[model samples]
Target: MSKSCQGLFVEFVKCLRESDCMKASVEHRSVTECAKVSEECAGLRYTFFRCKHGQIDPRTRIKGNKGY
Candidate 1:
């Protein structure tokens, strides 16, 4: 069986919701703050990849940076 997270549909759905909320609220924070938080979250890259629930979210990225 694939260890990929694509199987966890519910988790993918929840990630979508949180991404939306984060995107919507992003404008409320300063660029510096966004960068700080984004870095903090990115630090959890290993956990995100191991999620086996959902992949990393673009909206969870910095406000104006392209994703890797």
Candidate 2:
């Protein structure tokens, strides 16, 4: 993981931890179950994805990465 995306990753994890899906997953000892309700954190996920993609994409590098 790149240092630039770490903050986004932390935000995404915090969002996940706040969701009901994650609470239930913790109760059931199943982590993957939270993925079903991931839409709640879609925006953060997309931003993180873009940040990671930008690291390897020449066009994004030239154009400048989208800011959070």
Candidate 3:
């Protein structure tokens, strides 16, 4: 990847690690809503991304299907 892309990847990983405390709340919300509240793909963005893409696991606390 390009230097900028690599930097972003590193930042993303750091951000996710830093946000490991926020658990996903189960609810029902559209991708539009998730995008509205997401901290720019950092903390809960990954959870919402999984929800939007239908890849979230229902068994976890982050049942991301909700308005996370």
Candidate 4:
């Protein structure tokens, strides 16, 4: 991951650890059922995704990364 996206990545990981998704994963006792579709983390995930994609996209590169 790029340095610009690291902050968002850290935030996303923190959100995931605190979210019910982690609880569900614990309950199931398997990684296969782990779901990152939680409502709270959705926007963070989207922002992180956009930031990462922007790094490689020329058009977005011109517009600049909207690092959050």
In candidate 1, position 7 carries an lDDT of 41
Residue-wise lDDT of candidate 4 within 1-68, one digit each (tens)? Answer: 67889999899878877777677665554322332557778888888888899999999788778776
Residue-by-residue lDDT tens digits, candidate 1, 1-68:
22343344344334444443356774686533543455334434334355432334455333422212
**In model 1, how large is the Cα lDDT of residue 38?**
54
Sliding window of 10 residues with minimal summed lDDT for model 2? 28-37
Candidate 1, superposed: residue stretches over 4 Å from native: 1-3, 8-13, 19-48, 51-68
lDDT of 2 by residue, 12-55 (tens): 88988887777666567454556445788888878888899998
Error of 1 at 25 (Å): 1.1
* Residue 19 miss distance in model 4 (angstroms): 0.3
Q: Rank the candidates by lDDT, best first.
A: 2, 4, 3, 1
Superposed by TM-score, candidate 4 places the C-alpha of residue 15 at a distance from the truth, in angstroms, of: 0.2
Between prediction 3 and prediction 4, the one with superior lDDT is 4
Instruction: Give RMSD to native, each candidate.
Output: 12.9, 2.6, 14.6, 2.5
